[model samples]
Target: MKKTARIAAVGVIATLALTACGSREDDGDKKGSSSNSDSTSSSAPTDASSPTEAAEQYPDFKACMVSDSGGFDDKSFNQTSHDGLVNAVDKYGMQTAEVESNDPSQFKDNIQAMVDQGCNSITTVGFLLADDTLASAKKHKDIDYSIVDFAYFDDKGNNTAPANLKGLTFNTAQPSFLAGYLAAAKTKSGVVGTFGGLNIPTVTIFMDGFVQGVDYYNEENGTDVQVLGWDRDKKDGSFTNDFESTTKGQNVAEELITQGADIIFPVAGPAGLGGLQAAKDNGAWGIWVDTDGCVSAAEYCDILLTSVMKGMDVAVEQGIADAAGGTFSNEPYSGTLDNGGVALAPYGPNADIDSDLSAKIDDLKQQIIDGTITVETP
Candidate 1:
């Protein structure tokens, strides 16, 4: 039987560092886990998770997840990735574990802790974890690993998936273009805006597609609906600097709204909630990312327009299930429209979108899927 140890919240990086050091030796010698330590008031996991679930159910397969600095309750991207692992926990009745990195520096140590705890397979969330996940995968060849939003490439840029590691990627630009078009068509103000958590490829990809969508709308309708916060040709735009601060999110959205943007899209993960709040406070409609905001961030549902879906739940669930069934492979999985890996969420039921516009949106989706339209991302 696997022992299930309860974990309190892990609040700070310093405390987690100490715990990692103190628990190091014993960690490698143990087969069980210390679950759910949310030590910080600010970094706390909003909902408590079962420290360990039915370890005895799948003795040979133990799964784990390591979150980026944003933690699991970001209510958007990271949460979607984590949900996949939780799905496996419920469906396969496997022993599961998770560690939320309160800081970037803690990523490696957190991964080490999961390995020490004997996680057979581990999934690291977001592009920020790519390098650390690669290093760990190299060091621990016996365990399987997967990364979300990053592809494995050598220093020379050759596509590669190191031994025992898989890369989960998405062509989200495909669907985000659809969203951009929607915003352009629906904007009562002639301007819309988008901002990211950082300027990484994964974050900027959405921005690229959005601006292009707006541009496409202009060419098609001869209207000058402008985009704020991003300039695709320059590959530069607005970034919140971090994924965890709602204040920064609110500030950015407030700034863009003040600049006459009535439709807002925030890709800042947890911090994006600040934008959701700002949109509500300032009379702007919001477009969500990763998961459906109306479902994940139900508090802001009434003001949500739609979401550029990443299908993280579907992808992560598939990865874990593949590992559990002994068919795990390191081949990269790219979520594209053809395979339902990426999509645009439907407009809210009570939204002002008329039947004709809705029909047009539907037509655009088919065009993209059929390759009549191509969405590009940097």
Candidate 2:
């Protein structure tokens, strides 16, 4: 998934908290027990030979998860990952558990705690767990582990892939491209903007795709719409480097607005809230990321254009299911627009967005999916 630096850092913070603190919950806290594992009621198919049925192979296996700095209900990354694990539990007849840590030192302890609880497969969400995940994987060779939005490594072996561990990522560029196209079409000032929490590849992927989308629109429609905030080719983009600071996001949005950008896309986590606020103040609209920005940032809901969605929820569900069936692979799984795992959110008030423009964008999406058009990733 395309993660804003703020969200990524929170995951690490949570890991630290878990390892440093004795226990995530308070003393005598016994609420950390399995909630439910009723398989018959799930959406999973019943045929034993079916692809979904393979998850039943490990009926006795227990699945566990660890959330980074953000709580499970962070309305973004953590919630989506948790939903996937919940689906896996109901489908595979497996027990489920989770630990929420807000500090950085808690990662190793969280992984170890799940193993100690007899969990067959454990998942660590967020890039913050890279070091801790590798350590946990090496210390407990018998346990299968999966880390989302992060890769594990060993000094002597291939850092890209490791046995007994799997990595999950999404082709975030595709959806961001769509978002850029929409932003360009919707801009009244002929200028659109975007910003993020960091400058890493995960974040740049979104910026790169967005820049390409604008170029596509200009080339195809013969329109000279301009992009503000970030320049993918020149590798210059606005970033807060902190997800929690709304002030930083607001400043970036204000600058873009001053430069005539009437539409903005903020890829920051909670910090995006500031961008949303700035859009309102500037009488513009903003595109949200990860989750439905309108819903998460309800205060600025009306100013939202749409969202660039990455189907992390579905990917997580599939990953846990694979582990339950003893079919987990170290291979990284990629969620793309074609798989319904990622896409642009439905247009909001801008739904009536010039039918011709919409049709052209849709055709472009298909061409990109069919490999007729390429959306490059940097």
For candidate 1, give the lDDT: 0.76
Q: Tell me the tens digit of each residue's lDDT in model 1 across 1-378.
A: 311222223211100010000001222222211122243342222222332444444545777888887766667776677777766666666766677776787778778878987888999998989989999999998898989998887789777888688899999887788789989998999999999999999999988888888888899999999999999888888889999889999999999999999989998998888998999999889988887665567677678777787877677877887887788898889988778788776565445677677777778778888999998874
**Best candidate, TM-score:** 1
TM per prediction: 0.85, 0.77
- Worst ten in a row by lDDT for model 2: 12-21
RMSD of each: 10.8, 11.4
Error of 2 at 233 (Å): 3.1
Q: Judged by lDDT against the true structure, how good is candidate 2?
A: 0.67
**Residue 251 of candidate 1: its Cα lDDT?**
97
Best-fitting candidate, measured by lDDT?
1
What overall lDDT goes with each candidate model? 0.76, 0.67
For model 2, residues 1-378, the per-residue Cα lDDT tens digits are 322212111110111000110111221221111122222221111221112343565566777787776556555566567666766665666666566655557667666766777777788887778778877777777778888776544676455656778877777798788778877777788999888877766667788888888888788789999987788668878898866568998998899899998988887666677888898998999877765544444455567666776666677777787776768888777778787666765555433466676677678778888999888984
Instruction: Give the clash count for each candidate.
Output: 11, 15
Off by over 4 Å in 2: 1-60, 103-105, 151-159, 294-300
